[model samples]
Target chain A: MAETPVRFGILGCANIARKVSRAILIAPNSTISAIGSRSLEKASKFASDNGFPASAKVYGSYDAVLDDPDVDAAYVPLPTSLHLKWAILAAEKKKHVLLEKPVALNVSELDAILQACESNGVQFMDATMWMHHPRTAKMREFLSDGNRFGKLKSINSSFTYEPGLEFLQNDIRVKPDLDALGALGDTGWYCIRAILWAVDYELPKTVTALREPEFNEAGVILSCGSSLRWEDGKVATFYCSFLTNLSMDITALGTKGNLRLHDFVIPFQENVAPFYVASNSRFVELSIGCEPSPSEHAVTTDLPQEALMVREFAGLVGAIKGRFKA
Target chain B: MAETPVRFGILGCANIARKVSRAILIAPNSTISAIGSRSLEKASKFASDNGFPASAKVYGSYDAVLDDPDVDAAYVPLPTSLHLKWAILAAEKKKHVLLEKPVALNVSELDAILQACESNGVQFMDATMWMHHPRTAKMREFLSDGNRFGKLKSINSSFTYEPGLEFLQNDIRVKPDLDALGALGDTGWYCIRAILWAVDYELPKTVTALREPEFNEAGVILSCGSSLRWEDGKVATFYCSFLTNLSMDITALGTKGNLRLHDFVIPFQENVAPFYVASNSRFVELSIGCEPSPSEHAVTTDLPQEALMVREFAGLVGAIKGRFKA
Candidate 1:
């Protein structure tokens, strides 16, 4: 018999939810079971617009979605402030949780959500979609190669976008009450994650925030940067902002090799992602030029990165469900 | 009438002198007249090895090169400590000076050299070769385009190279008594210059050195970095080291576009150079990917950057000589 698909109940009608809901629908092992909003009309419209199947239900409140017996998982696309409450409640109702990035305001709140999921025997995952991209794994292979890349020496990452004046004034991201961390939480999170991932999750010995981060009238960070150093001489720096043109870059330099990619967060093309790498580069005669220049490596994926993320999360949810039945 | 070529006297037989001597010979407006070292045999060997013209004079003492009436300009490639003495003496001797980078130990010594050059009516320039690359001018054109690049926001640069054990143990750059600034002076100079160039030579309001710079056993910095902030909210960070793979990168992000180059200090190829630029890039439907990907721009040159540097410096020297004669 074919395996059962992971049924998802989405909490809130967030702008990001539209993308993730589409991803869930595209993912082979996942399907939208229900969607809930503060207003029933809004939830109903979201379900129809997102092409949720006729069997999918619409609910007026988040509690009603969690109360549905057929909902195997809850995708929480709520604001940062409401993450701790809704995520824990969803876990308590024995539903797997897929939380949006800047998962919680702080580690303690995230820990509470993790603990609740552990006790209820449900899976939890942050929606860092890039992690699921095939290109990420290929880049990891190059970084881990001792002969090609050697020891990690330095890394620099930047993620920035210009979202316009109206969004700056009205978006929940810039509002202190809705997303206290603002640009740092939204954009800087990816930079920090990329640094950590490059170093195989080794925490830096020291992290110094670059002086005078830019802030808005509401006191939310508009732009910020930081430098991190490890005990073994590895160092990294990152900049994130909502004030500049759309740019996502990561450059990692090792003892014998270097890797660079301009569109690390969201690639310029959905079908193929490219990165440039140089190994054992040396200046030619007269120091006029490098003997071997960097070469571009493009990795293609059949499924979109977000859809791959949904599939991975649903696969884990299915395994957990199997364990519970056993 | 054809303009007379500027005649150059080299101050020392430093390793870098070989490259500059070739550049002087290749540049149509410049020629090597004489080379000097502490030992006559070493100077003779250097002049012959570097393919200097048969008319080129070889002298034992640096003063002999300065005294040579045929030498119109002096290329001082001596150690950083020796720069203050030789550059000032060269300027006083009425020879135009092309001093190697990290021109002096500090500002006071540099100021004294500048004062000598001014009083003696001699031209002085640091040997920063990449500034003369044709590609640099093309990149500048993009950066200065308001509609394309907009306002400068952030810049990150890194120039690093691993020169092997012999260099680490014996090179003048690592010796505290010779080049006290070590990697910061040798490599970091390029990074700092690149940042300033991106901002159109405007000095930063504040500069904070990143903590815990790596130091050699003789108390010379082997690796260092700093963050610079401007009053207008522009920020820049740079890292330079002698302990990593050969890499020279500059990534400058503006409000409307970004510019990136993997080899900014030296082009990866002598005949052509490239930089990447993305202007007005935006996400496609559903934020799947950027609509317009960054495009690579290649600028070709008939002469190598070093040769172009020699030509530019020689042209300035000729102009100054004409002014004095008039």
Candidate 2:
């Protein structure tokens, strides 16, 4: 018997779609069956440029993508402002979703998306790809081990960069309608999400926001902090900024010792990536390398996001198929 | 002409008074002239045991201590719950005042104390002795030096410890009337103060708070993050906690590199005390000796609060005497 692959469609020719659609094509048990954009010309060009399968279809509008019978799941990489509209429509059409990060502009919007997915009995997952990375799984395991980092006393994480106006002009991410979707939302959200995931999804009780508004026209926060608490009374702090050059790191402290991931925001793909663990008055460095699956081709690519997302989506599909129960 | 020393009378036989009174006796131009406590017996015994001048009088009440003509300044080391009342009384008496940390329970109480001091023209300074320590001065210098850490990005700091029940059972710090005075006020204030000082007191625009109430009966925050922004859009974060065993450290990230101070809560003293600074991608161990002018005491003996209070008070006295311009 031949195993059937999950058919996927791209909703909106978002910059993220270029990345996510590539992952979909390479993902095990998955096929990019359709592509969509606001203009038919754009969709057809993207499909042709990316060498989409001859059998794959092209749609002029996002609604047309959802209406396609061959598309079983949809990757919604629409602009932040349009996430809610398309996500609800996708769920209503009985299509499972792998929605891009921020999921929505705020928690309230995320709740609505959750409700729509649940009510329609369609599987849904936030494409916080880092959460599904094997390194994250290892981090969670190490935290649970208790001997390594001890009870987590505090967390500090940051993701920052200074992308020029030219970069912003070409990137939909810098579009103003996204509510100054500057660093805090674009990159800071990842820092917040990583810390939250490490602490088992403990929501921040109070958030003290500080923003360098001059960096962005929309009065968006250039940097911000979320002071969070776990049920065990542990505290976590998250920080993000877009006003400066690129920096991605997370440091966690505990009673017995501390652990620091030097470049945590970007996962280590090669043998040179360094992580530090300190305990009992001694510090040790560990070299971390990504382990590619046997079924996949190992291309000389710096595509941490692409590789991890494809692997994770394939696993999620398998879990839904009961190959493994969550 | 005989240089007349400023006579200092300390109210309350608090542990902090012992350090302040000693500093006063040994200060270049000061004397431990008198002592006072709620109980006359405790006041008299403390005076005799500590070797106050024969002319120094013991007072049964705080008001009596303030009334003494020999008492040029009064050191108020009462409980956290009573800082405001004593500070106000001292300010009203036209006495130079050196009040202990938190200055007051909240900004309102601190404002009242500041107003009283401003109106009376009495020199008032919070006894945050660490600020006077050479290590802090050095940290600030390193942070501001463009050749060193460069533009400040983020700050991560924590001070926590597991104290015995007796340490807090009857302590006013754990009392409900004082309102969240445990970690946030006690150790956490140091973290807040350091961050503010590091960023040159750039006030935060918005504050989000998360607290662990179980750690203190008064709902004192076990940990908190104060996100701040400056006029130029610099961002900073401060974290403090008291639930776990002691771990006091500060990590500051900058454009070129970062600096990490291990055991920041304690002074970097001689052979017995050491601190590590990570800068220029190398860890340097700092061995700091005790202040030479005071005595040949171990650097560890120099509590930040004690050193800072003494130095500031000495400067204030000089300013008031017209020997030094303010």
Candidate 3:
């Protein structure tokens, strides 16, 4: 028998919601049931522009989406200030929460959202799409191998893009009232997450921020960097900027080998990604050149990473519902 | 008409001398005339093993090599502590000096060597082979283009190698008396040089050393890192180690583009080297992927980088000799 597809109700017609809504339609185990914005016309236009299914409802207010009986899950891509209010309300309505990155303005707000989800028995996940990439899993295998890539000694990550003058002047990311964390929260989130992922999610013992951070007139960070040191002498450094050209890179060096890739956050191509690895690289005779050069490993995926993320999230929701029915 | 070749007398039988000797023989404008060691037997064996010309002289003492009339230049690959003595003597003897890196124990010693070379009108050059590679010039062109790669925003470099336990225990790089600066002077030199090269040799306004540097029992640094900031908000970071797998990388991010290369100090192959360049990279529809992805540029050279270094030094010596004779 085919399992019932989890129905998703998207909160707000945010730009990112267009991508997630498409992912819901593509995932076999999920479907878009409704989309709500502050205005019915905006929601209707968004649904029409993004090609929402005819069965999907459009709501004028976010509350209507939460109240919809067909919405088993709510994908919240609201501004940072509104995440705390809407995410908690969705959980209380017995809706699983798929929140956008920078889940909340602060840790306490995130904690409150988590508590509400636990009490209401609703699943919660941040929409970090790259985590579901098959290439990430392949890279992880190389890092976990002791003989090929021993204990990681150091890592460096950078995520930067020149979003142009119009975005810099008008984007919510640059406004202190909307996305307060700015580039640090928007782009640095990936860099910090990458470092933690390389070390198996172990928090660094010490974190020192690099000096000379560039900030806009509204006190929003335009560029910044930090150095993190682990208890076992492992070191990591990252730089995130809104003023540089697009570049997402991660370089992890180990005692026996190394791993490097330029497009870690979003691959150059959606279906295929490539990473370079070198093991036991040694200088050739007379030190004229290296003996074993790094080789590129390209991994292909049938579905987009966002679709994979949705499938994984919907599967979890289905398991919870099955347990309750049993 | 063929210009007179620069005849080189190599001081000491250090392992590095073996590579430089071959480069001297390969370079069209340079040739090995003599080699010196503490023992005549060792000097003769080194000459035979390195396949030096049968007409080349073997001296038991370094003084004899410096004093030889036929020695137009001296390739000094002695330990750091002895650089001040040998380099100054070579310059005073009117022989152009091609000295290895970490040229002195301190700035004063380096100054004395420079003063001697200036007074005697003898050409002086450090044996940093990668500086002479054609690929370095190609990468510089990308960085210099205002439309392609605007003002540099940040750069990160790393030079590391796992030389095995035997080298860690017994190598002169780990000995305080011979090479007190240790990995900082041996490997970090390359990282620092790369950062300077990217920035057009402009000095940084401030430099702060990263914490948790590894040290040997003799108080020699095995691994370390530092962050540098320029007056115009450009930042650079570098890490160098003797305990990690061989990785020499340079990732420079600019306002409009980025330049990245895995083998910066030495190419994976002596004949060809590659670097990646990305200009005006932007995310495609719905930010699913990036467009105008990084492209690789490969440069080929007939002679190895070391031979190019020797040839450049020989050309400089020939020019200086021409000036003196005029």
Candidate 4:
């Protein structure tokens, strides 16, 4: 018998939802079943704008979509302030949840969402889509190789882009009421995640925020950086901003090797991504230069990374449904 | 008449001098006139081992190299402790000095040498050979590009190498009475210079050394890092150590582009050097990836960077001589 794909119901019509909606349509194990907005016409327009199937339902309110029996999972692209209410309610309705990044205002809110999902017996995952990139796993393999990479000595990452003055003054990310953490929660989150990812999720023992983090009038961070140190003498630093040119980078150095990639958050091309690796690197004779140049590794995938993320999440949902039937 | 070449007298038979001696030989307008060590036999062995010309003189004491009238300039490669004495003496003796890096034990010592050189009317330049690489000039051109690489925002550099335990415990760098700054003066100097170079030689307004610098039993730093902040909000960080695998990197981010090179202190190859550049980089639609990949730029030179440094230094000496005769 053919397995039924997990049915997705998007709870908000935010810009990111358009991308995720396309992901759901492309992921083999997922399908867009419904979309809801405060305005019925806008929800219908979003469905067509993002190429949702003609059979997909359009609803005037979020409650109508969650109330339907076919929405096996809810993709919440709502602002941070709305995540706690809608996500917990979606869990109460027994729908699995795929929450957007900066999942909650703080750990406590995230804990609440996690507890609700646990109590309701549903899956919950934040939409950190890059974690599902095939290139990430390849990079990890190099970092984990003791003979090739040795001990992790240091890492530096930065995620920054100029969003212009209008966004700084009006974007939901900069508005404290909507996303209180501001750039730290948005861009800096990726930088911090990259550092943690490079170090195998090892938490640093101390974190000292570098002096001079820029802030708006409402005290929302516009740019910031921090340095972290581990007990084992490992060190890491990260910078993120809304004031610089578009730049995403991660550089990890170990005792025996180094890894660098510029487009960590998003690859330049959907089909192929490249990373540079240098193992056992050293200077040439007389130290006039180096020997054994760094080699570039390119990873290609047929499906875009976002689609892969959706496929992975929906596969977990499908497995859970199969368990219930059995 | 043919332009007279600059005559160089080398003080000490240090390991680095062997490389510089070859540079002097390869450079068009420079020639090694003499080399001196504490033992005449050792100096003679070094001269023969390094393929010095038959006319090159070998002497028993550093004083003899400075006192020789035929020696138009002195290349001082003595340990830091001896720099204040020998560098000043060479300047007072009217030999245009090519001093080794970490020019003196402190700024005051450097000032005294500079004062002597000014009083004696001879040129003075530290032997920072990477500054003369054709690749360095190319990188500077990119960084100075306003339309391609707007205002500089941040920079990070590191220079590290593992010389093994035998050298760490016994090398002159680890001895407090000798090269007391250890890794800071040895490896860190290059990193600091790279940061300053990226910002057009503008000094940072504030600098705070990162905590927990590893030091030897004799109070010499073995590993350390520092963060510098410019008045205009530009920031930079640098790290150096004698405890990790060989790595040299410099990454500078600007408002319009970024520049990165894995081997900034030394090129990976003597004949050709490369650096990666990304201009006007931006994420593709939906931030799935980036657009316009960073391209590798290779610069080729017939003369090694060290030899180019010698040619530049010698050209200055020759220009001074020409002006005096005119």
Candidate 5:
């Protein structure tokens, strides 16, 4: 007999859910038990399209979905402005949560989420899909090797897109309730998270910023340059932008040499995808020829790594069920 | 009749003198009439090698060089550790001055140097060679053109080198200084200045940094990453390293396109270097060329664009002499 799959319920039919739903379907030992949206029609459509099991249900309200006895965990893909509210509610219902990136609109929100999760004894993890990719693990290993890149010197990274007029008109990304969740939160967060992870999440000693008041109507940043100095004298600088055309690059320089990530904003894929390593004044190319682990098939979606993230989430759920043993 | 040339003196037998001395020779209406060193033998040797006229003087003590009435301006290149003391002494002697980069150890020292020049009514300019290059002017013009690159998003720059053991041991760069002058100040300053200048020197709202503690013996940064947010929402990042092998590259991303400068640091030649511009997802080769000013040709040197800087300096001196009427 197969092990029972963890039943997942998604809160809100967020735009990102389109991508997350696909991951849930393909994730091993995980099943979509239900879905909820403000509108019953939307919830039903999402459940039917994904072919949720006959016993699975659809709810008009997020609270109804959280209260479902069959749902073991909740994936919170709410807008930045409402992430804290739904995440706290999910925790109150004793549901494990995988909150979306930016985790919360601000540090205070993050703290509140932390407190809620702690009080309820529920497992919580920020749903930073990029972080879940095995390539990120590869990057960390490369950095830790010490003999490869040497002592860390600086980092330069960017993730930008040309979000067209439709997005400019109605996307919550432009709304005020989110409070500084524009480029810095929506896209720039990836660059920030990458740096934080690369440096073992060392808090920066200082931070200064500039913002485009016109585009950043919510006063979040459209493009920002930040310098972070770690206690060990390691430094990094990163840039994020919302108004520019597409660009995703990360370059790290160290004492002995440097490493370049050609498309850091995206996941590794089989084929001509290439990164470069520089040492002794010459550059060597590291190309992706075979599919990297977490999935056997060639990645086809814009975020092909999403399936791996879901699989990992299922494993974490199993660990929790097994008394927190990995 | 030709206007009287400003008689000049150099106050140290430093490597930088090779370039500056040549500039003095080619500078319109200027002549190198005196030189001084800690040892008379060294000073005489420099004077003899350059075929100084019999009327030209050589002095054992730097003070004697400054005391000469024929010396209207003085070039000082002692050490990164001793720029301020001599610059002040030169000002006291009523001589105009050209101090090498990192004009003072830190911003405080820089401010003091500015005050000294203002108080003495003497022209003072930091010899940041690239800042005076004609190509830099072209870059400024290109960036400012709205029809071109469009709204600026990000900047990434680095300047690094691998000095031999002997150079490293004897170099003032390795010594202790309070101004964080090693990598960040020495080589990194070029990247910083380039970013600052590209953005019209807009003061950053905040700055956070990290430095390598090992190379920063006196706590000077050997490698650093700085994040800067301009008031207009533009972001820039700068990285510098003394430990890495030589490499220099600068990239700027804008809304409409992107510009990549492969060898921004120590460019092969002063004029007509090739760069890549990507617009509308198509890459095009763009040649950035500059006409050598007549004054530049006068000062012959092989340090890429050193002669161009000399010509600009000569213009600045002339402008100041004409009461800031440039």
Candidate 6:
């Protein structure tokens, strides 16, 4: 028998909510049960615009969504500043919380949210959608293959895009109070996560920020980079920016091989992704060129990565509920 | 009506000379005229093994090649420690000099060689083959197009290869008295040169070496990296290694576009090389994916990059000779 599908209530009508809402609809084990916005009309329009089911309720206040008996979980896509107040409140209401990344403004806020979730027995996760992509698993296999990848040495990642003038001037990300971490929290998150992920999540021993970070008029970081060194002598460097053209890359070098991909965050297509691998590559006669072209590995997925993330979150909630019922 | 080919005398039988010798034979405007080694037997063996013309002279001493009237130029592939001595002598003897890179132990030595070439009115060129590749020109076109590439913002380059156990132990690059600059002179040179090429040879305002460079037992760097910053706010980073699998890459990010290629030093195939260009890229619907994939540009050449380098150097020498005779 299939497990019970999790019902999700959205806390706000943020722009990112539209993408998550669609993911909820597409995930087999999830459904959108409620949407709450400070303005009920905005919530209604968002639900309609995103094609929410007629059964889904629209709430004027976030409290109404948490109070709903049918809503078992909440997807909080609120501003970074509101995460501390709202995520913990959702957990206090015994609702599983799927929080947006930069999960909270700082460690204290995240700690409070985690403590509330643990006490209330509610599951909590962040919307780091790229982690759930199938391609990531395939790449991991290559990295872990000793015969192919050998000892890990270095990793470099870049995630940057030109956000244009309007976004630079008016977007909440540029505002000091709204998304204060700016490019670091927004795009650099992926670069750092990718480096950690490539090295099997082992924390770096030392982290030195690169010099000459470019900041906006409000002192929000527009571009920045850092280098991380591991206790085992492995090194990683990453750069993230909002002022350059779109470029997403992850290059992992090993003693015996290397792995590279241009689109690590989002694939060119929703279903398939490609990564290049060069194993035990050697120069041909007289060092004129290398032998054996880099092999291309394409990984396919049944659903978009975001949907996989929702399904993964709901599966956790479903397991928790099953244990509670028992 | 074709200009006479420049007669090249090989200074030593270093392994790289094998490749350059083939290139000299292939380049229509260049030919191998002599080869010098400490032993006449070794010089003769090298000439015969590399398919030198039967008439090409074999000299037991480098001075013999420098003094030979028929030798218009000397291709100095001697160990880095010997560059200052041989390159200056070649220029002093009125032979144009094609010196292998690292050029010297340091800037002061390089200045002496440059001064010798200038005072003697002999042409001087460094044998950085990739600089002459047609694909380099093609990539430059894209970078120069303001409408497509805009101002370059950042550049990241990596050049590394696992030379295996024998080379790590016996290679001149690791020897204290020879190519002691090690991986930096051997591999990092290309990374630095490529960064300079991307930005039109403008020197960076500041260059800081990355921490935690791996050194061999002989106190030679096996792997290292550095970051460069320009006055115009352009930044570049490069990594070079002798302990990693073969990997060469250049990722140049500009305001309006990006240029990336996997094989920047030596094209995977000699005849054709490919680079990916993403111009004016933007995230597509719902920020799920990007619009339009990077376009691939392929450039083909009849002769390999080294041959092109020899041809270019020969043309310059031929032009000088024409002036002298007139």
- Cα error, residue A50 of model 4, in Å, equals 0.8
Better of 1 and 4 by DockQ: 1
**TM-score attained by model 1:** 0.99
Instruction: Report how far off residue A8 is in candidate 6 (Å).
Output: 0.8
Better of 1 and 2 by TM-score: 1
* Per-residue lDDT value at A52 in model 3: 92
- CAPRI-wise, candidate 1 is high
RMSD of each: 1.0, 10.7, 1.1, 1.7, 9.5, 1.1
Better of 4 and 6 by lDDT: 6
lDDT, candidates in the order shown? 0.93, 0.65, 0.94, 0.89, 0.68, 0.92
User: In model 5 chain A, where is the ten-residue run with the lowest total lDDT?
Assistant: A286-295
Residue pairs clashing in model 1 are: none
Q: Which has the better DockQ: candidate 4, or candidate 5?
A: 4
What local lDDT does model 2 show for residue B30? Answer: 73
**Positional deviation of B201 in candidate 4, in angstroms?**
1.7
Q: After superposition, how far is residue A126 of candidate 3 from its true place, in Å?
A: 1.0
Q: Indicate whether candidate 4 or candidate 5 has the larger lDDT.
A: 4
Scoring model 2 with DockQ, what do you get?
0.09
Q: Identify the leading candidate in terms of DockQ.
A: 3
User: Which tens-of-lDDT digit does each residue in A289-318 have in candidate 6?
Assistant: 886668889998999999999999999999
Q: Candidate 4 residues A1-326, lDDT tens each?
A: 66799999999799899889989999988999999999999999999988898889999999999998989999999989999999999999999999998999999999999999999999999999889999999999999998878888888899888777789889999988998888898999999999999888888898888778878899898888888888887788788888777778898888888888888888888998889888777666677776567788999989998999999999899999999999
List each candidate's DockQ score. Answer: 0.82, 0.09, 0.84, 0.65, 0.15, 0.77
lDDT of 1: 0.93
What tens-digit string does per-residue lDDT give for candidate 3 at A105-129? 8999999999999999999999988
Per-residue lDDT of B1-326 in model 6, one digit per residue for the tens? Answer: 98899999999899999999999999999999999999999999999999999989999999999999999999999999999999999999999999998889899999999999999999999999999999999999999999789999989999999998999999999997999899999999999999999999999998877788999888999998888888877788889999999889999999999999989899999999999899998788887788667888999988999999999999999999999999
Rate residue B138 of model 2 by lDDT. Answer: 64
